[model samples]
Target: MRLTVLGCSGSVTGPDSPASGYLVTAPDAPPLVVDFGGGVLGALQRHANPNDVTVLLSHLHADHCLDVPGLLVWRRYGPEPAAERALLYGPEDAALRLGTASAEVGGECDDVSDTLEVRGWVDREPVKFGELSVTPFKVFHPPQSYGLRVVDSAGAVLAYSGDTGACSAVEELAQGADVFLCEASWTHDPGNRPVGVHLSGTEAGEVARRAGVGQLLLTHIPPWTSREDVLAEARAAFDGPVRAVNASESFDVVKSGSAVRRQTS
Candidate 1:
C-alpha cells in the first residue's frame, strides 16, 4: 500500500500547498482519495486520473472538501471521460453538502451522481474499496466528523485523524497503525486558543504515543503556525518517528507495520 500527500495546509490553502488532501493506493487497485480540498484537483492530476479514484471525506469543511466540484467537472468533461462512476464516501448529507458547494449561479446543486456514486459512512462499519478496507470512527468535531482506519489486504493499517481535537476516538482509530496521519492545527498553549476543535502538536504526539503507531506524520498545519515549532512540540511528547508532511511526498506501507517515507519532489 502507498500513501501520498497531495496537500496538507490546515484550515485554508497556503501559498505552497492546498488545504487537505491525500491519496492512498495499492497494487492492482484504484486509488482512494481522502479529503479533496481546494487546489487538490490540479495536484491530483499530477498523480492519477480523477475518474479512477474513490473519494472519502472526513467532514464538510470547505478546506477539507471544496474541490469536489472541480473533480466532477474533470470526470464529466475531461479528454478521456470517466469510463466508470467513482465512489464517494463521507458523513450523512454528503451529497447535499457537496452538491450545494458545487452549485452553479442558479444556486441549484449539481447532480454529482451524474459521475460519482455517493455513500454515507457509518461509524466502525468497514467499507471495502478494492483491496483496502476503511472503518470510520466518530471523533470530536463540530457538526459531524470521523477519523478513519484503513487496512490493506496485507494487514497494513493507516489511520487518519481528520481535523479532530483530543478525543478517545482518535486514539482508538490510530491504535497499532503503521502510519498515523494526524492533524496539528493549533498551538500547544490551550489557554491561548479555543478548545475541542483541533489538536496541537503536543496533543498529536500524545495520541501517537498512546496508540503506539509506527510513524506519526503531522498534517493539517496552518500557514501561520511554524512547522519547526510544531515538530519540536510533537517530538517532546512522542519517542518515535514523527515527521511533518510535505506536499507530494509518498510513503510505502509494509505489512510489518512500518511506513517508509519517500520524497517525490
Candidate 2:
C-alpha cells in the first residue's frame, strides 16, 4: 500500500502547502483520500484523478473538509466521465456540511451526494471499500472527531489522527501501525492552549512512541509554526523514524513479518 500526502498544513493553507489531506492506494483498488481541506483539489489534480478517488473526512472543520464543492465541479466539468464518481465517508453530518457548501457554489447537493456515496461512522466498527478496510475510533475533539486505522488485505496498516488532542483512543487506533499520520498543530509549550482542540508536536510524538508505530509522519502544522520547530519537538519525544510530510510526498508501505517498512517518496 502507498500513502501520499496531498496536503499537510493546519487551520489554513500554508504558503507552500495546503491544509490536511492524504491519499492511500493499494495495487488492486483506487486511491482512498483522507480529508478534503482547502487546497486538496489542486493537489489531487497534480497527483491523481479526482473522479476515481474516495474521500474520508476527519471532521467538518473548514481546514479539514472545505474542498468538496471544488472536487465535485472538477469531476463534472473536467475531462473525466460523469459516471466516475467519488465515495465519501465521514461523520454523521458529513452530507449536510458538504451539501450546504455545494449548494452555495451553484451545484446540486443531491446530485453531488448521489454521485458520491456518503457513509457515517460508528465507533470501532469496520467499514469496507473495495480492498481497504477502515476502522474509526473516537478522538478528543469538540463537536466529535475520529482517528482512522486503514488496513489493506495484506495486513498493512496506516493510522491517521485527525485534528485532535492527545487521547487514548488515538493511541489505540495507532497501535502497531506501519505509518502514523498524526497532527501536530501546536508548539511544545503546554501552557499555550491552541483552541483546546489540537495536539502539539511533542504530544503527537508521544502518541507514536507509545503506539509502537513503525514510522511517524507529523502533519497539520499551521503556517505560523516553523517545520523545524515541530520536527525538533517530535524528535525529543520519539526515538523512532519521524518526519514531517510535505505536499505531494508519498510513503510506500511494505508488509514485513508483523511490521511494515514505510518508505518515503
Candidate 3:
C-alpha cells in the first residue's frame, strides 16, 4: 500500500501548500482520494487520473471538500467521457451540498448522480473498496466528522484522525495503526487557542502515544504555526518517530515482525 500527501495545509491554502488532501493506492486497485480540498484536483491530476479514483471526505468543511466541484467538472466535461460513475462517500448531505456547489445555475443543485455514485458512511462500519477495508469512527467536530482506519489486503493499517480535537474515538480509530496521519493544526499554547475545534501538537502526540502507532505523520498545519515547534512538541509525547508531512511526499507501507511502518518514498 502507498500513501501520498497531495496537500497538508490547515484551514485554508497557504503559500506553499493547499488545504487538505491525500491519496491511498494499492496494487491493481483504484486509488482512494481522501479530502479533496482547495487546489487539490490540479495536484491530484499530476499523480493519477481524476476519473479513475474513489473519493472520501472527512467532513464538509470548505478546506476539506471545496475542490470536489473541480473533480466533478473534470469527470463531466473532460476530453474523454467518464466510463462510469465514480464512488463518493461522506456525510448524509454530501450529495446535496456538493451537488449544489457544483451546479451551473444559482441556487440549483446539479444532479451529480450522473457523475458519482454517492454514499453516506455509517460510523464504525467497514466499507470495502477492492482490496481495502475502511472503517470510520465518529469524532468531535462541528457538524459531522469522522476519523478513518484503512486496512489493505496485506493487513497494513493506515489511520487518519481527520480534523478533530482530542477524543477517545480518534484514538480508537488509530489504535495500532502503522501510519497515523493526524492533524496538528495549532501550537501547544492553550492561551492562544480555542477549544473543541482542532488539535494542538501536544494533543495529537498524546493520541499517537496512547494508540501505540508506529509512526506519526503530522499534517493539516496552518501557515502561521511553526512546523519546528509543532514537531518538537509531538516528539516530546511520542517515543516513536514523528515527522511533519509535506505536499507530494509519499510513503510505502511495510511490515516488520508485528509492526507496520512506512519507507520514505
Candidate 4:
C-alpha cells in the first residue's frame, strides 16, 4: 500500500501548501482519497485516474471538504469521460451536502448522489471499497466527524485522525496502525482557545505513542505554528520516528514481520 499527502495545511490553504487531502493506493485497486480540500484536484490528477478514485470525507469543514463541488464539475465537464463516474463515501449527509453545494455553484447535479455513493459511518464497522478496507470512528468535532482506519489486503493500515481533539475514538482508530496521519492544528501553549476541537503537536505525538504505530506523520498544521517547533514538540512526546508530512509527499508500506514498514515515498 502507498499513501500520498496531497495537502497538509490546517484551517486554510497556505502560500506553499494546500489544505487537507490524501491518497492511499494499493496494488489491486484504484487509489483512495481522503478529504478533498481546496487545490486537491491538481494533486489527484498526478497519480491516478480521478474517475476510478474513491473519496472518503472526514468532515464538512471548508478546509476539509470544500473542493468536492469543483472536483465533480471538473470530472463532469473535463475531456476525460471516466473522471465523471467516481464514487464518494462519507457521513450520512455527505451526498446531500455535496449535491446541494454543487448545484449552488451552478454545477450539474443530475445524478451526483447516484454517481457518488455516500454511506453513514458506523463505529468499528469495516466498509470495503475494491481492495481497501475502511473503518470510520466517530470523533469529537461539532455537527459530526470521523477518524478513519484504512487497511490494504496486505494488512498495512494507515490511520488518520480527521480533525479532532483527544478522544477514545481516535485512539481506537489508530491502534496498531502502520502509519498514523494525525492533525496537529494547534500549539501546545496552554493559553490557546477552542480547547477540545483540535490536537496540538504534542498531543498528536502522544496518540501515536500510545497507539504503538510504526510511524507518525504529523499533518493539518496551522499556518501560524512553525513547522520546526511542531516537529520538536512532537519528538519530545514520541520517541518513535515522527515526520512532518508535506504536500505531494508519499509513503510506501511493506510487510515487516507482523508490523508494516512505512517508508517515505
Alpha-carbon runs more than 4 Å astray in model 2 = 105-111, 194-196, 257-265
- Report the Cα lDDT for candidate 1: 0.90
Write the residue-wise lDDT of candidate 4 on 1-265 in tens digits.
Answer: 8888888999899877789999988878767889999888777888776777888898988888888887777667768655345677677888777777777456554347535666667777888877889999999888589999988887888899999999888988999888888998876886856767998888998998899888888999888878888898889998888889888788876545334343554
C-alpha-based local distance difference test score of model 4:
0.82
Clashes of 3: 0
Candidate 3 similarity to native, TM-score: 0.96
Off by over 4 Å in 4: 104-111, 257-265
Candidate 3 segments whose C-alpha is farther than 4 A from its true place: 257-265
In the range 1-265, model 2's lDDT, one tens digit per residue, is 8888889989999988888889888877777889999999888877777888888888889998998878878877777555855678889988877887888555445446556778888999998877889999989899679989999988888899998888789999999998888999878787668554888888888998999888888899999988898899898999888888888888777555334344555
Count of backbone clashes, every candidate in sequence = 0, 0, 0, 0
Q: What residue pairs clash in candidate 2, if any at all?
A: none
Model 3 score (lDDT)? 0.90
Error of 1 at 193 (Å): 1.6
User: What are the clashing pairs of model 1?
Assistant: none
lDDT of candidate 3 over 1-265, digit per residue (tens): 8899899999999888888999999985689999999999988988899989899999999999999999988998999878999999999899999988998999899999999999999999999988989999989999699888999888888999999988899999999888899999988888877777899989999999999898889999999999999999999999888899989888876544334444454
In model 3, what are the clashing residue pairs, if there are any?
Answer: none
Error of 4 at 104 (Å): 4.2
Candidate 1 per-residue C-alpha lDDT over 1-265 given as tens digits, one digit per residue, 9 for 90 to 100 = 8999899999999999998999999985679999999999889989998888899999989998999999988988899998888899998999988888778856788778888889998999998877889999999999689999999988899999998889899999999998899999876997798888999999999999999999999999999999999999999999999999988888887756446556564
